[model samples]
Target: MQAVLRAACRAAADLLFPRNCVHCAGPVETGSYQYLCPACTRALQFCEPPACKTCGYPYFGSVIAPRECPHCAELEPVFDKGKTLFLAKGPGRSLLHALKYHQGFYILKDLTRMLKETPHFKEFLSGAILVPVPLHPTKLRERGFNQSEHLAHTLLQNSDARAVEPLLLRSEFTHSQTHLDRKDRLQNVKNAFALSATANLMNDTYYILVDDVFTTGSTLNACARTLRTAGVTHLRAVAIGHG
Candidate 1:
């Protein structure tokens, strides 16, 4: 009854003040996603198979032979594999920015919907334990939330993932990697993470690191190194977008 009431209330509220697209300042009238207009929804470039195993970037349909992904060519990943939802361009970029910067919590429903409907997405996440990339204490206090942690929870609810484990902690408040080169980004995060005291990982179980976006993968690699040092043998990673 409460859920029904909430839905009814939301419907009435939407009618009163229609939601605007995150990418464009247009009314979201008809689209599979609630936060994007139909054109923007159609503009999303989803990742498909024959993708880069390291960063989940598509191979542009080149099935001839697997080649190195330019995105993470220099990365030496501690995790066994990586998967992402879409290219972090166009509407996809705005979607993540909205969540990461604007406190767009309402956009989570779109993630759930995508996980349920996107081909092979749920399968990739269904059986693993998810670990969200951590934010430093200072950053956490400033941001009031960790977007990666929110992503982990949404994935847990949407897929058959075992559980969400905050098994890593950012011990150092590293400078933001937004404008840094790949080398600088790596150096900034090096030795910045530590294994959390609450972590009780098993050798045989699959573990997947979750984040909102995959840039040069420096940050994720840093987190994975910490987990690997703590004896996570079966590990992989997933993100909403590959930038």
Candidate 2:
């Protein structure tokens, strides 16, 4: 009865104030998602097996013989493995843009739903400690909220993760990596992260690093290096999007 009432209330509210699709900016009249309309939701791509173990970008074409993943070929991973929810293009890019740049906390529900439906991603987070790649104090102040931290919390809420820990702290306020090449990116984030005081390194516990996007894997590697130096043994990573 309560569920029916809530549904009816939501229907009435939506009727009064229709939502625009995050990707296409079209009216979201009918869809499984609240933010993404039916067309854009269908455009969203989910990552599956035959993906790169280092960065979780899906492989195209033949899978019998493995080929190098273009995304993380330059990334020397300090963590064990990695996974992502989707390819960061098309609808995926718009979703992240809204969240990271446009102050779209409403997008969290959609992301959480994606995480739940992506079985491998949910399974990867099981029984692990989720570590968000922290923003530097300056960056945090500017952004107002850390998307990585939010993503870590999302993982914790839906998975059997032990907890969300801000174990790695960004010490250096480096410029954005959006335009930096792999070599420049590697240099930019080098030694930019350090372990926080609360980072209780347990050799037995699996620690999964959470980030919003895996563009070059440089930031994630740096965070993993910090944790590894602090004595974390079982380390891996997961990102919401992989470009």
Candidate 3:
């Protein structure tokens, strides 16, 4: 089965327009299979040094808990810890837009590689189960794919960790978070997620909610709160981009 999947991937690569890096738009000469060239791969940034111990937001210069950027201190994220691979600025933002809006699925491999190479990823993810923040049924149908789930699959494939696609589910439909005020964002996503009754996760299992972007983190917070009600003990969150 693995061999077949690999062959299919290779064939798809051949058919989809041969071997070009998605980031730098340069030709890749030698690599197993990826959409990022060596230069682009080198250019991709991972959050490092002096980040929030609770939420993985980066802090420059000093290694102290940043004054809890207005987003964190006000509401307090439900997840015990959170981390992101990119700062949601520069090329990182552009790449995320392409992956989410344009469905540039090929970047999954590169994103996986980035996550694997991230300095503190495994330490932060230790003993935790991955759960991609789910899309509403309406949105899922419209998009035809959940980018979070796609990223989760890539993470699992490249790392020893495992992930569940729908351990957390959206309980209500809400407006997009774009341009919404912080209070409105929280209210819009309130009571918007719930755990599946069939999920056998114990209170002891550390869960990591997965998503593509972490803006105000209202959505992840809502999801974590639902899991808390369901008896999740130590919770964390992971995302590709952070603002």
Report RMSD for candidate 3: 3.9
Model 2 ranges off by over 4 Å: none
Q: Which stretches of candidate 1 lie over 4 Å from their true place?
A: 1-8
The residue pairs that clash in candidate 2, if any, are none
**Scored by CA lDDT, what does every candidate get?**
0.91, 0.89, 0.76
If ranked by lDDT, best first, what sequence of candidates would result? 1, 2, 3
Candidate 2, overall lDDT?
0.89
The ten-residue window of minimal lDDT in model 3 covers 62-71
TM-score of each: 0.95, 0.97, 0.82
lDDT of 1 by residue, 1-243 (tens): 999999999899999999999999799977798998999998999888879888899889548866888998889888899999998999999999999999999889898888877758788887899999999999999989999999999999988899999999999999888899999999999999999988898988999999999999988999999999898898899999999
Q: How accurate is candidate 3 locally (lDDT)?
A: 0.76
Better of 1 and 3 by lDDT: 1
- lDDT of candidate 3 over 86-117, digit per residue (tens): 77765577578778999988677567667666
